[model samples]
Each structure stands twice: as C-alpha cells, then as structure tokens.
Target: MKKGRNELLAEEEKILAPYAVSSRNSGSRAYEEPEHPYRLPFQRDKDRIIHSHAFKRLEYKTQVFVYSEGDHFRNRLTHTLEVAGISKTISKVLGLNEDLSETIALAHDLGHSPFGHAGQEALAELMKDKGGFEHNKQSLRVVQKLERRYPDFPGLNLCEETLLGIMKHGGGYETTQLLEVRRTLGPSLEALVVDVSDEITYSAHDTEDGLESGLLKLEDVKQLSIWKRIESSLPNSEKKSDLHSHSISRSIGRVLLNLMVSDLVDTTHQTLSKHKIESRESIAKAYQNKIKLVHFSEEFQKEFTELKQYLFQNLYRHPEVSRMSERGKETIYLLFKHFETHPESIPESYRKREGEDGRMRIICDYIAGMTDRYAIEKLKREGILWFPY
Candidate 1:
C-alpha cells in the first residue's frame, strides 16, 4: 500500500527534529483549498513553484554572466537548483524540514530581472518614486498577485509557512509589517538553512565560473585564505603539482563547497546546543534574544568573508563583467522607458489590468518577467539597438 498524506505527516512527526516545522502545523494558505490526498503542504508548494511560469523564465536569466556569454555558465535557474540541493542537505543533517527549505530555495530568486543585479538596479532606479523595487519584494509579489494560474485565486496561494519562509529569508524591513510573524523572532531553522545554502552555492560557483571564463586567474585566487585552507585539507597524493593547475578549478569549487557545508552543519549543531534550543519554541526564544542558531564558526566566517571580498575585487569587478553590466543596465533602461511611454504595446492581459495595478507597476511587472534573450530581442524589434552584444 502506498503512503498517503496522513502517513507522510506522521513520518515527518516521528523523524524530524523537535524544532522542525511539520506539515500538520503549517498555517493556512491565502486562499483555502482542499488538501491533496497524498501530497504534504510543503511538498505541494515545491511542485507549485517548480511549475510556475516565473520559475521557467529563470533558465534564460543571468547569474554572473549573460545568456550569450556561454552555454556552460550558470544561469539563475541553475543557481536556484544548486541552492535547493545544498539547502536540502543541510536541512536533513540538522533534522529540519527539507521540503520547506527546498521550496524556499527554489523560489528565492524568482523575482530577479533579466540581467541579474544590474537589471535589478536599473529597475530600482526607475521605480524609486513609485515604490522602490527589490527582488525579494518582487518575488513575494510574483507569488501573491502577479501570477495568474488559477481561476479561484490570483497567485499560487502557497501555504503560509512557505510564504513566511520566503519573506523571512529576504530579511527585508517590510517583513516587520506583516501581521503573521512577530517582529522579535527570526525565521524558522529551515529558512536559515536555505539562506546560508544560497550564500555557499553562489560564492563557490561564481568562483568556478570566473575561473572558467578566464576573468580570474588561478594564481591570484590560490593566495586567498579560504583557498589555502581547502588546499591544506586535501590528501597528500591529491595535493600534488596538478592541484594548482587551472584545470582543477572545478575540483577546487567542489572542495570549497564540501568544507563550507561541513563547517556550517557542525557549527550549527553546537549553536543549538549552546542555546538549549531543543524544541521549536526554544528556537524561537533563542532567536528573540538575538542568538544566531545557524552559521559557520567565527574562524570559518572570516575566511569565507575574505574569499567573497577577493571575488568581488578580482572577478565581479573585472572590466569584462563591468562592461556586460553596463550593457544590461542600458537595455533595461530602454525597455522600461519605451514601455512606460507606450503602455498599449504591452500584452492585452497586462494592459487590461493597468488601472487595477497602476500603469508603472504593470509595466515593471511585464519587464521583470522577461528573460534576458526576450528583452534583447524585444529591444531589437523596436529598433532600439541595431547590433546584439
């Protein structure tokens, strides 16, 4: 006999840690619907996010490089998948809710514009007066109001726990105003796991992408404290001359990911123990008192921070990357201006709802949903630019 939803819920209650958020205790959705016969709430949420149009659009969106940069580079969708994988590993190790963590990881970047941070910056400047645009807020908006998948509801109508995890992961000031969460308490352990997993995935993978692109050299990065630490930990035979070769960049990325994940898991266990956080309520109390329950040790954190700083100085700020960023910003600015001046050019579905959502916001939403290729093609169609970069 196959297990049903009740059986799965019972398993979660028995197997998950005391601090984990079980499906039975998950709060109601914005719009109520009958529960599935075999799928748990968080599991259903994961499926819903996976099938959303916004999620699909991530494939063509930028991560560190534009879509045209190369086929091997990580796009937003790939990065999201990596975050989900790492978060699930950490959550399972910590006995937290892996399903909720994975769902939050998958949805975290849905609101990012076409060209990564550069595109988001352009939109933020354009929407400054209308109400500043941040990707996290846009992500919430995407799930809550923008997506039109169901006849009975406007958006995905995700369970409140999933929604709360998404909102809390961003740690924006606006989270305070939401009545469902208390201002003093931090998010669930599942959310914290996803947040750290995101950091780990991006830092490690961006380094690999930078090395692969030839924008960052192995010699320069190997001098970083984190790299040296990872190097020292390798087996004696594996630490031979070939380890320093550029060909080992992928190997380095793998080792760095393992080191970080191991450090985080062990350190978090110690944190929970130190704070006496054996139950969900105790975890909340610890957070209310400003204790961090999920993080690396102080020594590891310093090394990780140094690694990020080195990447920022050497890779993310490379002339090639800056050039790409400038081009992306220009493209976003042109698209926003053109659409604002000619709202009729927008699809009939969006144009029809302009009065309800406001013209500027409607335009923003339309542009935000575009893939990098789509935005570039649209610009070419409008004769805004003659040549593609």
Candidate 2:
C-alpha cells in the first residue's frame, strides 16, 4: 500500500494506526476527515482532553494534599503534566501516538477529589450503598457530561481510542479479567501504554517526592524487595540508587526515562514484526522493566504500606481533617436537599426526568463537581454548612 502523508513511515515494520477514536467534543470525531488537511488523529485526542470540563478541574484536584500548607510537591495538575511528559517520551521512542498518550495521561486523574484520596474515601463511604464513586468513573462522567466549552452538550466526546485508553489505564484489570472471562481479550494498545506509564512515573515520582519531603531516601526505598531485584538485574542499578535527597530527583528521573524507553521501544519493535493487516499486535505490556521490578522489593513493600498508613493517620484521618471532611459530606447533603426543594436552581440542561431521586442525584452531581475551595466557599456563603454542634 502506498503511504499517504498521514501514514506511518515504516518500510519493513508494519505501522500501527493510531487506535480508533470518536471524541466527545464533536460527539463523534474531532479529527478532520481523512480528506481534510487541518486535523489529524492525535490532534483530535489533544483537543478533546483540553476541552474537557473535568480536565480543567484537575488544576485544583489533589495529588497529595488538597490544601497543602506548602507550595511545593506535585498537585494533581502538575502530576498530570508530568505523566503527560513521560508518556509522550514513551510514545515518541516507541513510535506510538504522542498526542494520544499525552491526552490520556493528562486526563487520567481528572476525577480526583479535593483532598486527594482522603476526600475520595469519604465520598465513597457516603455513596457506597449508591452506585459508588471512583475517580476514574467520575473522570468519564466529566468528559462525557460536564465540560461545556463547546456548543455540544456535556463531555468533550473524545475519540473512542482516547476514551478506551483512559478506561484501561491503572491495571483497571478490565483487560486481564476480560481476557480471562472470554479466553480472548483485545484492548487498545494506547491503553496499555498509559497504564504502564502511570505505574512507572508514580512509583519513581512518589518516592522522589517522599525523598524531597525528608520522609524517605533511596536506601529507604531499596528496603523494597522489588527494587532490590530490579537493581540487581538492571545495569547501573547501584549507581542509580542514591540516598542523597537533593540531587537524586534528577538521577532517578534519568534512570526511569532510560528504563521506559528501553522496554517500550524494544517491545514495540517486537510487536511490529508479528503485526498482521487485520489488527495491530501490541507490546507485552508487562511491568518487567526496572521500575516494576524495584517496586516489588520487600522493604519497599513495607514502606509502601507504611506510606499509606502514614498518610491516612497524619493527613487523611486526622481529627482536624475528619472534621472538615464530615462537614463536606453534610454540606453536600444540604445543598442537594435545597435542589430537591427548589428544582429551579439547577440548569435545565442538568435536569433529567423529574422525581425526588433524580433531583437529589443532580444535587449530588453538582456537589461532586466542586473543587475543595469552591465547595467550602459555596457552603460558607449559604449560611455556613458545617457539622452540627
């Protein structure tokens, strides 16, 4: 087949088309028809993500603390940027669609709550009996029904491929399970890349953040059994594993970058060799690289557990935080109650079929959409929605 300008430039290697996509923005596709010159597949991916209302909320979402006393550390916004950066590098090296990876990575955390996972836990508790709340699902909601930049209804209506990639990221286990269930599973290759990229970036980046915060060091991390094995087998593991807090971020970043490029590129090449015209053969998509290996270390495993325990104790479940969180739940409840009493407050667009349950659901959706600061401010203005004395 003669390669067009938009076609992948591979001679012996069978080039994989960017996965099939239908964005939420245009509600079908943001990409220009193949005949159009201006829009491309990847560009559509970028546009859909950028246009998402959920994507915008990410600016205020938490990577760690929703309202950290300090300016340092990665908030969800910065973290998304970092994920996009690393994902793009992986895509570039492996000849994947950089825009698709970038959009998927950036949008991955779109549904995170104000106080990080703590707030999410609280919300989930409230909604456990209901359909339940996972940031990942919320992200899908945001993109599909929240963002309104375009004249189109709600979500960005991003490409199907981008949507699939987002859905599959984070070992959502949808793939492994689906494959197991039917004995045959096929997920978009972009989804697999984003998932692995997330693991790789967060593992190193979180450790880097811990080191920066004076809570951990390379030695502390090496305490992990997984890190130990990866360190032993991977070249220059000893040199890369440094305890020095200050210069180590740069070093660790380099090591992670090297590890990702090596595996993704090699696996991609291998996949290409076996590619048939019917479907694109995907890379192994396993975390056997140095990053994954190091993650399984025993000492590190204990620390990983400890880190969660520490965050819950010191940050998430603290009395002061809990007080605020409880108030958050109550406030959401009251605000929702008001909407039930006065359906006029909600936009007609959000109003679904009429009923008490439907009205309350809208109220919940509104409250859920709020940023921490915005939620607080909204409550304060509305006669101080705080916990009862």
lDDT value, residue 241 of candidate 1 = 51
lDDT of 2 by residue, 8-111 (tens): 32321243343322221112344333333445555655776776666677776556544443467667777788788877776666555566678888788877
lDDT of 1 by residue, 282-382 (tens): 87788778888999999999999999998889877889988988898999899888988877678998888888878888888998999999999999888
User: Local distance difference test, per candidate?
Assistant: 0.86, 0.56
Candidates in order, TM-scores: namely: 0.95, 0.67
Who wins the TM-score comparison?
A: 1
Lowest lDDT 10-residue stretch of candidate 1: 170-179
Give the Å error, residue 360, model 1.
Answer: 1.2
* Per-residue lDDT value at 54 in model 2: 63
Give the TM-score comparing model 1 with the true structure, all chains together: 0.95
